[model samples]
Structure formats: C-alpha cells, structure tokens
Target: METYDALLASITPGSGETRTIFDPATGGVVGEAPVHTVADLETAVTAAVAAQPAWAALGHDARSAALFKAADAVERSAEELAQLLSREQGKPLNGPNARFEVGACAAWLRAAAGTPLDPEVIVDDGETYAELHYRPIGVVGAIGPWNWPMMITIWQIAPALWMGNAAVVKPSEYTPLGVLALVKVINEELPEGLLSVVSGGREVGARLAEHPAVGKLMFTGSTTTGKAIIRSSADTVKRLTLELGGNDAGIVLPDADPKTIAEGLFWGAFINTGQTCAALKRLYVHDDIYDAVCEELTTVANNMPMGNGLDENNVLGPLQNKAQYDIVANLVDAAKASGARVLLGGNPDPGQPGYFYPTTLIADIDNNNPLVAEEQFGPALPIIRYSTIDQAIEYANALDVGLGASVWSPNLTAAREVAARIEAGTVWINKHGAVDPRVPFGGAKQSGYGLEFGVEGLKHLGVPQVING
Candidate 1:
C-alpha cells in the first residue's frame, strides 16, 4: 500500500518537471508523478529492444502462459485495482468499472491463447516450395489514453506479446497511475522488458514513437495526435495501429421504440460520463419520433446521479481531468451560442470539483454545429432530427471520422441494412459500444488505422517473412 508520493521517490522520468496526481473527487493532490525526460524514454526503448529477442525466442506457449499469469495477477488484485482505477480515472463503480476491465484483460489473454498464426503457402510441384511466416516485429510502443487507461493499455500489450513482440506503454498524463499500478503487479510474470510502463506527457510519447529501435507503435487517443504519430512513425517505417477519436452517430430510426431507444441513447452517450471515444456524440432521430424520443432520453439522462466514483449510489463521476472538463464546457457553450436548444443538462455544477459536466442533451442542431461534426469527447450529446433514413445515414457518414455507429431498430432486417450503410468500422444493431474481445476493434478514415483486440490484432504485431525452399 505504497502512496503515489512514496512510489514517486523510486521512479525517474519527469525529473525536473514537478507534477501532482489529484484525487478528482476532492480536488486534492494525490501524489507526484515525474514528467519523463527524452533520455528516460530512450532507456526504456533500449531495454525493450534488448530484452525482446529472448522473449520472442521463448515461443508461443511460454508467451501465452505468461500473459495468462499476468491476467491472473490482475484478477487477484481486483478490489485494490478497481479502487485505484476509480480514484485515478473517475469511472463510476457501478458500471463494470475495474472488474470489467480485469475480466476483459483476462479474456483477451485466453482469446490470444486460442488465436493461431499461420504461414502462407505457395504452390509447389515437387522440390521447390515457398511459404510466408509471421515473425515478431521487435519492440512495440503502446500509447494509451486517460479514459479506460488500464483496459486499453492491456488491450495494446496483450496482442503484441501474444504475437511475440515486447511492448513499452506510455499511459496518458491524466491517468498514468492506473497503468503503472497494473504493470507493477503483472511485470513479475513477464520478461524484464516484455512489458514496461513509462509515465510523462507528449515529449515522452513522441520519443517512443520516433525511436529507431521500436519496430511499431500502437496508439489510442485524439485524431489530431494520431496524425502526428502517423507522421513521426514514418521515419522508421514502423507498423502502426491507431484507435483514434470518434464523433460517433447513433441513428434512431422511426421503427424503433421510444422507451428502448431511450435506454440505448442513455448508455451510448452518457457511459463513462460520455468520455468514451466511440460514445454517441450526435444522435440522428427520425423526425416522426424525434419529440417523443428526445423527451424520454432527457428524462433518463437527467435523473442519473453524479458524484465521486466510490459512492455506491452514484451513476456517473467527474471527467478524468481539467482539460477534458474545459473541452466539454466549451462545446456546450458553442452549441448554445449557435442556437442549438438545450433540452436537458448542459452545465457543470459549480460546487462539483473535478470535471463533472451534466449529462447534456442538445436539440434543433444540424451537422453545421460543432457538436454534430466535432469530437466533443464528453457527456454532451446533440440530437439532429432527420426526415428520412437516407438523410440520417448521410449525416452520419458526413464526418471524417468513422470509428463507431449504431442503428437502433427492433426490426433486424432494416437495422442490418442500415448498419451496413453507415461508414464506420463498427456498427451495432440495437446496441451501442457493447464490445467483445473476439471482435476486431479500430476505425475507418480519420478515426484511425489498423485494428486491435482480436485475431487480426495479433497479425499486426508481426511482419510477414516469405522464404523459398
């Protein structure tokens, strides 16, 4: 039970830059975190590169076993981990919270055990044969975001190691402690640099991405940052998997029930205080049920309790950090100035410390509004009524982002048809953001490049080597 202050004493990185971790609930300083230096990043990369070959040589079974052991370690530390995750990340305890994260981490390890890699075969007459096999791409750099920091970090590390590559993770500056804590528990089961956690801000992350020894980079964050990583990674021609920002649209067709639609709308938009990248930022409802749907959704959203994550009855928690709080606040203000009608909560409570903006719902907005087109990345969702299904699809597809979209219609036939039409990497029919480990998760267009969390994910960590024999 070492405090963050005690832990900071041993760790080096952000040497000169004195930063403090906050208890978001109380607006209290939780502990000090070093803003890592560029040289520290180089040391981490060098360790990962030097340690990776031996780890890769341990072969698949050993690697998979180690991952499972790490998963078990995570499970054993569930209570402590969940509390720490809540204290650091501000996610409510009611939702799957840290328990869900640990389960997913373990499930990923199990799924990776079953995922098989293959060597591509070429036609051979008699003596000559040719095949292409998968080989570890050396060291990988994983950059994780503040929202779901531990879960996404596990997502990045699990598949890379399963494919025989070592990973060096840079957790977001806002929620670095969760990853560091999780890593401390699991690192024993892994080889020295098979998995490592480094803390800091942009400088540390940039160094990791551009490092010559790092063979690939996997990132989950804003589209703006992803673009920078894409440019920086080009120097080494490293393999990249980016799960970037999403201004996802949830389409509520006329065929959908107002009551059911209200439920989906609530979870899709307000889950994680609407901090999820794929959370519904814009809602395109058929004009027929627009009024009724909006009313019901407003009722559901406004009634939910918001407070500290440790409060058992609280349904929502503060935004993870101040910058995100400002982003949510500014978006609400802009939508209002642009004449978008605020149908529900749109303001942060003055008394609330941390980033606690209300579960806001805006109406009478078209794609022209920033809330409709831009990634709000918070608890505010704007509803745009559409006269026709085509109009809804058109608006949903209009954005440069294509991360996730959901079609809410009870009719399977129509929902499937509409889901196919939406230009997003993931389309949930009658559900939103219900992710599974077996599925490939990523995005299309500016949302991001490459995939993670499934069979396809493991392939991304390795390079295809073709040999003729």
Candidate 2:
C-alpha cells in the first residue's frame, strides 16, 4: 500500500462501506481500498465525457504518443506493479505471472499505439466517392477482472484510448489496487480525467454499465454480468466489448503423441491456476490414448510447484479470493462424490491457510459431472474420454459459452480440420489461450459480442459513418 500512497490519498473516502484487499497467499490483510458509489461513477463519467473530445481532437498520433509513454511508464514500474498484482490476484510472481502480465501490458500498449485504423473506400469513381470513417465513441467505462487485473485492464482501456475514447475504469474489487496504481502511473502521462479509476464492487460496475454518459462499456469478466450490461446499455444502446466467461475444451486426437502434448496440455488448462477465461477446462482424449494422455498430463501438473506467489520457485499460487476458492472446492467435491476418478488432486487441503488448492486432475468424468459441466475456474481439470473425433467435437460444442478451444495433433491438416469445426471465436491447433494483440478476440453464442484486440477491435470502439458525395 505504501507504493500507492499518493493515489490512495487522492481518492475521496468511501461512503460508509469499504472494500479490503487481501493477499491470497497468506489470507492476510493487504489494505482497504475505496468502495466508490454510483455517484462517484457519475462524477468519473462526467469528467471523462468532458475530457474525451479534447483528447480525441489531439488525433491518433498524439494519442499514440501518450500510449507509448504509458508503456514506458509500465515497463519502468514492472517489478513494483507485478509484486502488487501477485499479492492481490494470487498469480505467481515468476513464470507467466505478474511480471509477465505487466510486460505484456507494455507490449499491448505499444501494439495498440502502432495499430492503425485504416479507412475503407466503399466506392471510388469519377461520378461519386463514398467511404466509411471510424470516429471515436466518447467515454468508455472499462470493467476489468481479477484474473489478470493489470494486463486485462490494459487490454480493456489502452485500445479504447488508442481509438481516441477517454476511459473511466472500474477495476475488479478483489484486485483494484494494482489497477489503481497502474492508472496513477498512466494518468501522469495522460490529461486529467482522460483516464480515471473508480474502484468498488458489483454496484459500481452496474452503474458504469447503465451510466448515460458512458458511450461504450468494455468489460472483461463473467457472461452473467455481460448479459446484464447488455440489458442496461439498452436505453443508450452503448457500444459494448464484453470478453466473457469461457469453458474452453481441448481435444487430444488418437494420432497425437501424449508425451509430446502433455506439457502444452498442462499449461493450457492450469495457467493462472486455471483462473483464465480462455484456459482449457474440460478436456476430451480419444479412448485409445486416454490413459497415456492422462498419465502424462498428471506427471506435468504434479511436478509444477504451488505455493506463495512471492516464492521465486512457485509457479502456481492460490485462487484469487475465498469465493472463487469455494466455487472450485465445491465443484471438485461434487465430481468426487459423483464417482469421477481423481487421478491427482480432488479437493482443497483443510490445513492450508491461503486459498490454495492443488493442481488437480480428475479422470473418467463425463459431461454430466459438475466439474466437467461447469466452469471450475480454478486448478481442477476433468479429463473425459471420447470414442471418436465426432463424439469429442460434439461434446465440446455443446456448451453455450464459446470463447476459445484447442485441437492437439501432430498433423496440422487434421488439427486445422478439427479446429474449424469447434464452436469458438478462437481455436488453437497445438496451443491454447495464446492470444496476440494483432488478432481479434471475443466470443460466440452467450459468451457475448464485440471483438477486442487488433484492427477489428479498434473499429469496435468507434462509430461507423459513411461519407457520400
């Protein structure tokens, strides 16, 4: 909290209620962050709305310059911010942990800065000329999630600013301080109110979703909240970019080498302790190689170290908070009770102080099992057996939430074929949840709408106006 003293001192005190931050590793108090009300959101939005036009008037290059400087600032404070992120979010300090997230943030900001919005000429002739112009929507209300608080906040806000929209961010209450500190660092490079942070819980997020002045609401969280935002934005018909929940399924084909794909499979599902939205949740392996794949994946998962984020050797940390920990615990317990074979970890350790659960693997589970059916969003993974490719694909696409999926096979052509059939916005051939700033990302079905990242994502933050003469 000492790192963020200046920023913390500036925020107006909360209205009676206060949200406390905790270190998931020790279950110790980190600090109490301000619990902003709807009135606070209103003020933030008003200021953002007032500031957006001038910021946009500076043009893309000027905005890009500011973004670049912000990236530099992030890079300079990478270690500090990453430490705060790890303590609050429970992702390890090393590996693809907070440091990696912070670095990716700088990279994303740079990419978003360089990313150009090219106008298209619909009709070009001597008689007439028509073109589609992308104009920035006013203020964007950015709601970030706790899973990758710092990086995802950058993912949500940087593009909005690049597209010339001023952002009023309401970061996840569980991990608000990291984002608040980030915004403090960033707002130094930006104009006052151009990028603002309003910290709170569900009420604050709901208010941002419905706030009349918020021209666009970009969210990174659950599908349930995304649906609510869609409904709330109805009156304003605000532009929305919702990166919602994903219970992504990965299929291991019979032709695939289990030993070779094991490492990829383990990290694909267990990254961020399986808290990732796009992490492979339920995995389907061909009946022939099911045993080999499970054995190999179990070996990899078991070997990975799980402990406090501050420990340099620890690769996996605790669940971000108690609520998510309970959710994961309940699902794994239900799976065990339903007769699913626990090839590895099946439940939380009762003696553990932090929200720690082992890197668990459950085998012989069917879609009927809670662990397989629901988004566990923790360290538990269920391995389901499929008789054939058709059966695997059928079960994988059965879910309403389709954010990302993966097909693992040595044969690229076969993998591509399987990948194409998977019902998801993004599909990986041999990899999973490997996202790039240059490509568009979002969801299909109930996962929500509007693409984020890349040229398509930049356009998503803008309103299309066709100029005809």
Candidate 3:
C-alpha cells in the first residue's frame, strides 16, 4: 500500500500546466492537478475505443475477476485515499465522511463484481425459443461531482467496467486530485487504456459528452449541467444516466418520538456536512411535536465537532469551496431576513480562514422561503412546521427535484403509507440518505434518470438484445 504522501506524489503533475488544489478546511496546498485539454480528452477517448473490444471479449467471468482485483487495490490504498479526500473535499476522516466514502468505493466495486447478470430465456415453447441479453456499450464517459468524488466515481465506473465497457472519467474541477488518485489505484489492477481520468475543464467535459465514440454518459452533478449534457449528447444519441440536484425532504410524523429520532434527523440532513445530493435539505415536522423535534435536533447538532477534517474529533468540516460557501451563506441570510428563527448557529465567524459555515438549524421558516425551497447544499437545514400529514406530503412533493426523501414515524405501516405518497426515487422509514449497494437508486422528476447500483445498475451500462429461434 502506498503512503498518503506517495499516493499524492503519484497523481501530482510534475511540470505541465496544472492547478494547485488547496485544503478547504485549512487553505493549505494539497497538490497540483494536471489541466488536461480537449486534445487530452480526445486522446483518452481514442485509447478507450481501441481497448474496449478486448475488454468486452474477456466475458463476464474474466471481467468480474478483474473488478474483484480492483476492489482489493482500493482496499490496499484506502487510508491514503481517505486522507487525500478529507483534505481536498473537506469531509472528516472519521464518521460517515472521508474514510466511509473510501470504504464505499471498495464495497461498490465488489458489488459490481459479485452481482449476477446472466442472459434470460424469454420463451421456450416447442415451436420457438427466445433469449434476452445485454451487450457492452463500447465506451462510457463518466462525469462525477465534488461532494463525494471518489465514491461517486466508483458508482459510475464500476458497473460500466463490469458490463464490459471501457470508461473515460472527468472529475469535478474542484476535487480532481482525489479522483485522479482513486483511478490510479484502481488502474493498478486494470488493463492499460481500459479506464482513464482526464482532469480537464468545461471544454473537455463538453467534448466527452458530444464525442461520437462514447456510447453512454454517466453524470452526477447539478440539474443545470445535466440538461446541458442532454443537449450535447443529442447528436450522438448517447445513452445517459444522470443523478442531478436534489433538495430532499424529510417528514417527522406526529407519532415519532422527537428524542428517539433526533440523531437520525441530524445525520440525515448533515451527513458530509450536508453536501450530499440526497441529504435532507428541507424538513417538515408535524406541528404537534414541531418545537420538541427542533429542540432535540439542535441539541444533537450542537454536540458534533466541526473543524479541520484531519482532526479525529472533528466529524464535520468546512465547505469544499468558496462558491458552495457563498450559496449556503446567502440562502441562510435570506432565511434570517424572512423572519426565520435560528435554533442553533446562523452566524459564521468572519475571521475564520477556511470556508467553514456553522451548523445552522432554522426554524419557524415558511415552506416556500428561499432556504427551504432552494438546494442549500451545506450544513444548514430549514425545519418547516405542518399541522397535517396531507400538508406535509404536499410540501415534500411541491419541489420538482425528487432524488430521495424520508418518513419518520414509530408506526411502520403509517410510515410506509406516507413513503408511498412521496414522489422520490427512494424513501427510507425513519432514516434518510442511507444508500445500500444492493438496492437500485435513481431519481424521480427533474432529479435526473437512470438507476445506479445492484443488477439494475449494470443493465444501464449495456444495450439490450433479443434473440429468437
């Protein structure tokens, strides 16, 4: 296993044009990432196209074995990866943050290797027989987001590679070093030219989306960028899987014990310091227990330490970048101006050097307030009060983006009933954003389409074919 410094040295560009990455928590120089251009993207695509057939010809068993080996590679370098991710992405090393994200990469790679996907016999009558099979899509282009860069890159590429497609990845400009290091580790067990990372700018990403050689595009980022990819891929008609922006809602039913569910609610909304795409952003608490719920959540939020990610005691860290920090700050300011009550922290220390926003909990906010309505992707949550279940459901479904949601209640049947009424890709009972690799997850409405994880995720990376005899 490579040490953290060695791993960083491996991905850091020695000479060419590069961008210096800084730690979001301390503003210290992390490393320099190569600034690949459109020409670099083309070269990567060409290499991927040339290498795909041999990879596809390896058959499922051989490919799965390679993926298993790659998973092992990830495990070997897990600590180094976690440290780098913690520094670059500003998620803590402990808790469900950097280390957890690194572990998830290994788990997902193993899941892609182990999940069975055999051809199915559709019909076997005496007169005729038919079979359905999935074929590789040649080359896949993966565009990952900064929030969970290492894990989400694994999410996009693992299944794609397992299904016999070579991939070219474009890491988010904000967090390129982590993704580059991750790909470097995985490539240790992979065939040369089969998978590559081109850490480039907008032009490279745009080129990858429109490249005729790329048969499919898997993207996880903002809704606006997803739409742009859709437009760019129109000419090539590439199969696209997009997991976009989400302002997920969590409803705390009147029957729920505020104290029992408070910790769950805190992590649901504040995991990865609330930078998750599916983290609960807006919460609706039944009026009967609204104040109690708010009090409990604030208590839970107050105890969690927030500081530099490298500190083991600090489970939460600064926002990953200045732009995201501004967005969260502005939304919270707007909420305060609209007469929203700050239950915990609403004031940030201007003297702080890094992009650290306080763990803020806003109560007594209108359902349609900008902080509640918009996607404040930070450690701030707006808790809205509702008197009726029907009203809570209405507020949750009012948003166009429906990536994920949660229904918290002591009564299982009631929670399931409420979960059924919500329009989202996945709804947890009494929990939020707890994604498992065995389950299929995607988004509803504008949150973007195409499933990732499990057997369903493998099928998305392939083309269906039917044979009749």
Candidate that scores best on TM-score: 3
Candidates in order: C-alpha RMSD to true structure: 2.5, 1.9, 0.8
Model 2 scores a C-alpha lDDT of 0.88
For residues 147-214, write the lDDT of model 2, one tens digit per residue.
99888899989999988899998998788888888888887799988888888778888888888888
Name the 10 consecutive residues with the lowest summed lDDT in model 2.
1-10
Q: Which stretches in model 3 have alpha-carbon errors above 4 Å? A: none
Model 3 vs. true fold: TM:
0.99
With candidate 2 superimposed using the best TM-score fit, by how many Å does residue 384's alpha carbon deviate from the native? 0.8
Kindly report which residue stretches of model 2 are placed more than 4 angstroms away from their true locations once superposed. Answer: 1-17
Judge candidate 3 against the unseen true structure and give its global Cα lDDT, from 0 to 1: 0.95
lDDT (Cα, tens digit) per residue for candidate 3, span 72-133: 99999999999999999999999999999999999999999999999999999998899999
Q: What lDDT does each candidate get?
A: 0.83, 0.88, 0.95
Clashes of each: 4, 0, 0
TM-score of each: 0.93, 0.96, 0.99
